[model samples]
Target chain A: MGYFLRVNILETILIYVVIPAAIFGVAALLTLVPGRAKSRPKYHSGDSWDYPAHWWSGDNPVAVGSIPDASNDVTFGGARGTW
Target chain B: MAHGEVVASTPLAADWQEPASGPLGDAALPLTAAQLELLDDVIFEAERITGLRYSVYLGDLGTDTRNMAEGLVKGLGADGPYTVLLAVSPGQKVVEVVTGAEAAQRVSDRSARLAVLSVVAACADGDISGALVNGVRMLADQAGTLPERTNW
Candidate 1:
């Protein structure tokens, strides 16, 4: 009985802990290895408002170049002034 | 594909896909034409690439960011399955971004801020749709890493 129990425990450790740890170890090692892709994302921007910088405002849909807000650095109303 | 076949209502039966006619196809979310346009131009565009629902609400809320924030949170909760909410109150020049609880737990404030910044930039550039889509895509990327909790 003791021999069987020991074998079961050993198999559990090997199957669960040892295999998972080995896989993680390989992944960690590979992570340290560098890759060739250094370019930023397609639309990556340090500043969020790098595109069109004007929005509509007022009853007549007048254009507003920029509206600063505490929450958002740049805020915009819709072109039709609906937003 | 088979057509003109009278079908019986059975548990084993599957429904056929119908073309969209008016506002949207049946089974699609009930939304206003304007809202649907926004979803199509902004949300749908972002979701196509990232597979996340991004909602935007433009309306007024009296002074107080906390109230606005709370209202936004409630609004997003009511909206169903939405990961993010970008609310704008033109009267107050207040912009509040309320992420769903799941998104909040997963997506960091910095990522949300970055998305907000992109929207602001887009407003500056006169491309509301572009800014919203880009921002939502970023938010979706941030939320994608989280393990989805099952509703059932």
Candidate 2:
């Protein structure tokens, strides 16, 4: 009877305490681990144009003019002074 | 009492609440989708007409707007000469037009000033997108005729 009681108490502790603690510990560790689910920057409507990666890339829907060649005599005309 | 009744008696209310004037409430980018599209179209059209690259930067320029504008123009790489960069800081009420050497030859300072005036006028009326469109068109018009292709 004493042995049976001891075994029953051990079984209750395992099922009620140990299992729940282990489950919670694993859950907390998983939450702390990096690269699980990363968040991205929120984009506004005009963000595509503001971001150089989007604007300069071919992915931009708007067709921007071609970049000039180095050999070209690129004049710095218009208003040289900043406003 | 039962366990369910004890749990139900607990209060879930918090002592603190988020302020109404938060970042989420602020307008990060003022322009709408259609307005951005309009500005893009205007810029592309200006580029096509002048045979030069046209780019618009709308943001804060810190204290020295001119230096910042110049740096932005210079950073255009090989396209700098054939590029016309319009930097507008609406908050500061400043507009700077930086042209590459090639673009400057066609679009004069006087023309740029005139374009600025048009943009300022439109801005005063609360039409930022319209201002950009009109400004680009005016700048392109003032850029004069594209050089003739001798090889053709």
Candidate 3:
């Protein structure tokens, strides 16, 4: 009786349930919002590539005009594969 | 941004580059900055370790992928003799690793095939960055250290 009088129902509910729930929701949202952002859609096999074709190298490969044709290719050693 | 790093505003896309034909214009690259950095580091490391130049192409290989790969490497001219080009066409789901005449002596066809297989496995799992980094490293390992070059 004394305890109940000291801590009212409203205060108990607010302290134990309302505040905690609010905190949990806010925390969850904070973590999940970043998580979702980081989970950017990655290319999966069989998935059509919607992005533009990009050529990435340490430096830009020589201009197209300078690129030798396959007929003149001396280095015939390499491997090719498909997934 | 780091410590006092400043982020700049730019009208050009992050991936903007001046290609042989012209510039990439305002086109955005598909990769994240982190992914691009990882790839760049791996290529740099691979070249340093193997004493060979490296390049990567990410795009379509057209109909004749093998020929296209050959042409790209052949086109490297002087660099072609020491270049190791790894061409990946995610759209077509194909990967080709071209080794120069000098590069071939260090990394055999069989070894290059092994690298290709690993890349195929990674591609199956949709790990393009992982495949490139690891596969490039694998090739570097296969190439071993330059015989005559002394690294002090």
lDDT of 1 by residue, B17-92 (tens): 5644544432222233453455456555444433334566544545675455555445433222234566544334
Candidate 3 chain B has its poorest 10 consecutive residues by lDDT at: B20-29
**Candidate 2 vs 3: which has more lDDT:** 3
lDDT per residue (tens digit) for residues A1-83 in model 1: 88777688779899889999999999999988856342222322222322222221111111111221212321211111122
lDDT string, candidate 2, B53-99, tens digits: 78887777768878887777677766666667777666666777888
The CA lDDT of each predicted structure is 0.48, 0.64, 0.77
Lowest-scoring 10 consecutive residues by lDDT in candidate 1 chain B?
B24-33
On a 0 to 100 scale, what is the lDDT of residue B29 in model 1?
Answer: 27
Q: List native contact recovery per candidate, as a fraction of 1.
A: 0.00, 0.25, 0.62
Q: Each predicted complex: what DockQ?
A: 0.01, 0.10, 0.36
* Clash totals for all candidate models: 8, 8, 0
Superior by TM-score: candidate 1 or candidate 2: 2
Highest lDDT: which candidate?
A: 3
Ranking by DockQ: 3, 2, 1
Encode model 2's per-residue lDDT on A14-72: one tens digit a residue: 99999999999999998887651233234322233342211210112212233335325
